[model samples]
Target: MDNAKLQQHAIAAECFVEVPFFDLDPMHIVWHGNYVKYFEQARCELLRKIQYDYPQMKASGYYWPIVDMRLKYIKPAKFGDKLLCVATFKEFENRLKIDYVIQSASSGEKLCKGYTVQVAVTTTDFEMQLVSPPILGQQLHQFIQAQ
Candidate 1:
């Protein structure tokens, strides 16, 4: 809950995705469901930077499933528009919480923002981990230490 610790331990990263024609609805704006995909792309990049991505999670004997997610749209994006999605680590204890901001890559105006929380489960027995696995803190610590 401490701001200092959160800031110090945060995993901050940004990734770019272009809105393709296929992602657009008839109105020419990106479909609402596609925003989750945008968040996923950025989340994967951030997690991969910390070696905590899906494959790594499986290798570490854990499976993390998204337990919650929310998105609020501020603007609509059209085809061929480049957007920046920034993912930041917010919490990791009983669950992993990550926040995301999607913005116009050129204008820097926020298009939407959201958060996702994932809980870990054992890969062997499929038992939910009440708290994150050891590797979570280890990777986070290493990332902070490196910074």
Candidate 2:
């Protein structure tokens, strides 16, 4: 399936955030990098709901760090603006991928969309994973089945 279609497999999380002063730049707009944190927040929430959060990942003897990230800005978000952030699981196998969408809460204007890719590494030898651990695959399968 294409990326658009894979969105169906997504486990989503939504959050409301007020753009902080520190997140803004000299032009008084939220910096691009801060969006990555927003995506992380939403994605972690989704993972936790399935009992597979970061701590569980470490306990499972694997480390999954973001290896790829992409973002498209559609509009600017200003400091103090309340916005909604949505993140969805996009893929899980050799890696975990998530897609994100950000929008202005009051105007409902689309602000940005992005995706992040994280690959698992064996904690013992630091070897990269060729396929996802059963723990993740099984949880994803169960989530899909329930949906």
**Top-TM-score candidate index:** 1
Clashes of each: 0, 0
Model 1 regions lying over 4 Å from their true place: 1-4
Error of 1 at 146 (Å): 1.2
Per-residue lDDT tens digits of candidate 2, residues 105-137? 898899999999999998999899888888887
Q: What is candidate 1's lDDT per residue for 50-139, written digit by digit as tens?
A: 878999999999999998999999999999999999999888877889999999999999999999999999999999989788889888
- Report the Cα RMSD per candidate: 1.7, 2.5
Worst 10 residues of 2 by lDDT: 1-10
Model 2: pairs clashing at backbone N, Cα or C within 3 Å: none
